[model samples]
Target chain A: MTRMNERLKKIIIIVVGLLMILLMAISFGGRERITAVESQLGSFIAPVQRFFSQIGNFMDEKTEPIINVLNYKSLNESLAKENEMLKAQVVSLTMAQKDFEELNDLKQSLHYVERSDQDNYISCSVIAKDIGNWFNMFTIDAGTEQGVTKNSTVINGNGLVGLVYEVGSNWSKVISIIDHKSSVGFEMLRVTDDYDGILSGTTNYELVGELYDTQANVHVNDYIVTSGLGMYPKGILIGQIYELVDDRDLFLKQIKVKPAVDFKKLNKVMVIPYDEYEEEITTYLP
Target chain B: MNKIFVFLMAIANFILMSTLFQQFRVYGVLANLCIVFSIIFAILFSEQHGYIFAIVSGLLQDTFLGKVLFVNTIIYIILIYVTVRIEKIMFKGNDLTPIFLISMATIAYHLIFFVFMFLLQSTIPIHQLLMHVIIEVILNSVIGLFIYRVVFKNVFGYKLGDYNA
Candidate 1:
């Protein structure tokens, strides 16, 4: 009799659990309804995650020799050699960039400069990461207290990072550009024939852009930047066109762009506080 | 008291895994400590406690990430109790049962999650995630083996939940 009762209880649990799963699955396509609950919980959990991050970082530094020697000895040597090569390349690139700026100044009046002043950005540190590598969403230490709000543009030193998705009192969730849902308007710097496209992220960790016309003359290594007409500030570097797929026959032709920001190594970001420009741009976004 | 301890431990594990252990990622996969704890909890206590904690931990994860809501909870449903049920039938009372179940549970839970999320129109690189899942399985297996001896069997032990070790 007791065995039968236990079995019945198990069956009841399985059935109820299935019903709950079905309800959640049906609502999967909609906006997550746990935003408020998450914000409250994030306020509680973020500091805990931050504390553990510090400890983990400490352990990583102290035991680096043991782990590195055991596993990354050869990997370290290769990385060192690669670092030297990259440093030299950077030096050469810097000189070339200086010359390019001069040429651009002479050729066109579109002198682009980054608005990275202390007043323009509220600097924040990453406190917690998403559960897995499936998506690049993360939580930052800044929140509504620091003037961060939902949909604010986030950028690191390199270039475009992501945008604020959710915000609490002391923390905010950032969704990186590599997410399939993210879309940013972009314009080609070299090909200034009014040839602009919207850059969107894909599942394969690639940023892709589709031009309005199928036969637009675009080439590999062409520079792309955020169009002044959208959420992101104008003239910020997006990436170089990596490849132009053979989608000429398709109605919406697409081109592959490598993102300027290295999503893998992102640690710190600066959130542009919501201002008149972003407020206006959000209205134009579909 | 024991239940509260388990709950606190589960929360702590979730916090640490998503934050601190992110640095220890290999192939961009962090070791899921909550899944490990849920497996241990289910085995030591009952299938009910295991799945219950699984859902709780999964909900906690949902708070951080914007994905299919309760997908983690739903995925975890099959993890704890089912693994425990399998252990009861196939390898009951074996000392290595926890280790095997933890590893299998972690891998299965993630694989099932990715598939379920994919079916929901979320695009995932199955090939790339598969590699990380394998790496995570091996990584969590080693971690489970270590914790089984040094932590689970001694520190918390089965006795806390009134189960014989």
Candidate 2:
């Protein structure tokens, strides 16, 4: 009986091991696509994740004030003395603000903001994020509850963050532009005549892109903004060209970009409420 | 009672690491608490317990963030197996044994993850990725030292030599 049981255990272990490998191959190897039904079943985890995410957010919220108090405890004594020291500094800061506004105007940012119409944006907090060192994916607190749909353009004060990919009742998953699958259409705002390019994120958390034509003069720190061809709103700043690399494609000038938004410290974002999509219809030429 | 405590602690750790830890980065690399827990389990518990935790935690991670399924699951399984194998052959009853194993596991887990990611997306730079994996390994190892001491030695009262084969 003992020998028979031992044989049976070994066989069972072998079968299970094979099944695990098969599952891994199917998923990671991308051999067979996960069916929609299976995907929907997988999404059943959303609510549970949302619950834990809320618990985490609650803890953070409760802890932030205490932390702030501890940090500012020493600062409190120096406040009055610092206030006297900072009075003249305020005038310099005001002048700096004016200079910043002038710079913004030079970039035609006001025009971009006017065209983009920020009124329809829904404010949301990040409740959870991708469970890895890669901050390429995350979840937001607002979802269908706040009328957030898939593919909404997500942004923060820094620049374009990413787009919503999946949505549930109260939460949604956001795939940042740094993810390998993400791509964005952008134009150089510094070049008024504007060179265009398509930007894609790499596994190394960097954005690499190619301009439509190499004729346009590209410089370091020249800002790139969305071209507004797709779901993205017009002129949303993506990032600045960090370096000009060798063009791999004959049709485009390859370049590297430094994304404006800090992917790691993202806490809040605004999702533009737009569901614009093009569906072309055709008929057989009878 | 210990099993229940471990299960709850795992859940709490998962939630904290996935969400709250984003705001608190150490040297631009987020500490992977899931990998840390699974390594500890593989070193301290029986194989069955270690395997179960690995799968459960791996599935949660995949379901929430994974575009392709079973990637995290397979990685966790690989890490656990490596951890178990290392534990059997290493010198036990040392203060640094768990820390050393955790560091090895961290490196192995990330190396495998990067290898798979490179297969999926061929654009990843090898040297740049190695730097990232190294940073994470060092960060996780430093954290594992304190965490193991508290959770293993003080809380669980686990001996320095608790490897079950």
Candidate 3:
């Protein structure tokens, strides 16, 4: 009986081990499917995310006043500067709105192309940071309840922040461009023309890009923007080229960029709820 | 009771490490206090207990990171096994040995982690990698010493001779 029990225990352990291995393999192999499942799961847990976000907001409310009280003079000066900036932004936006109205005629002429580019965006505040060391992910106070979904492009007022990798009912996880696995299609906005490239993150807090051999005419301080790829909309500011390193052996040039958005100080973000050129970009990739 | 307490403490330690300690990055190198604790715990406890703690710790790490699921489990298990085996041989409860062991283990863990990351085609620079290892070693050792004094000595009533006897 003892020997039989020992054999049964061994069998159970082996079965469990095999099951674990199989699960891991499936998780890695069917990554897209797993991601889809995670997004689906997000819809179910949106309310929980909302509750957490509310808690975070409550904490912030309680802490902010105390912090301000301790440093009132500095806080006042900072608030005044921020107010001035906000006024300037409002003025620019008002002018842009007017220009948008005037360009309605031109827009009608390019209706077919412009129609697809139109999208709805929702703004949400950062609720929490994801608990991890490897990936730079954060949870935001928006979810499927607010129409946020997986693969949604998230950005701050300044520039791109990241993309929604996973979403819960009221919260979503954003995989920042700083994450090692993240890749973005980018372009250089020069005075004359736009050149395309692929942006990747490095160990340092810098976004770097590898330009195509033909369109390698990039210089330091050149503005980088998201290419009008299916994943991201066109003309969105990415960063400025800080350095250009030439790889003689590979005949390739690497452009280091300082992202316009400071992720460390991120408070609120806008989620582009729809993919503008999804079909076109998917067709281009394998 | 002891098992439940240890498990809860490990979870709490993980939560604090991920959320609180993350804000205190020095020149882009963060302290891995959890890893240090795992090592110390494995060294102080029985081999079976160490193995169990390692698995729990790894699962806690995986849940937080959302990537590299089994990597932590496998690594921690190996680390605990090695630490326990070394403890059995050396059989000492000295201050210097714990510090040295922690420093070595911390460096080893970072190196092994870097190699795995490299295999996965991560883009971490060599200089930053070295800096991370050094910083983690120093921080973990300092923190390990304090934990040893407080938890093992004061709370648990563990002495250097506990292992041998």
Best model per lDDT = 1
Q: Which stretch of 10 consecutive residues in model 2 chain B shows the poorest summed lDDT?
A: B122-131
Per-residue accuracy of model 3 over B4-104 as CA lDDT, tens digit each: 76676776565555444444566656666656777776666555555666677676554334444455665666576567657767644577767877887
C-alpha local distance difference test of each model: 0.72, 0.70, 0.66
Residue pair clashes in candidate 2: none
lDDT of model 2 at position A197: 80
Query: Model 3 off-target regions past 4 Å?
Result: A1-25, A29-103, A106-119, A122-133, A139-146, A167-172, A213-217, A273-286, B118-128, B155-165
Model 2: per-residue Cα lDDT over A99-118, one tens digit each: 98898797795465332325
Candidate 2 chain A, poorest ten consecutive residues by summed lDDT: A277-286
Rank order by TM-score, top first? Answer: 1, 3, 2
lDDT of 3 by residue, A51-71 (tens): 555555556557667757868
Question: Once model 3 is optimally superposed onto the true structure by TM-score, how far is the C-alpha of residue B146 displaced, in angstroms?
Answer: 1.1
The complex in candidate 2 yields a DockQ of: 0.34
Query: Across residues A1-286, which tens digit of lDDT does each residue of candidate 1 receive?
Result: 9799869968976896788668667656434233566667878887887787667666767877785676687788889998998899799889989998898787667655533433457898887777765677888888888888767788887777877776777887788888876788887875237677898887455798999767778889877777756557666677788888867457777889888786655567889765654243321111
User: What are the TM-scores, per candidate, against the unseen true structure?
Assistant: 0.74, 0.71, 0.73
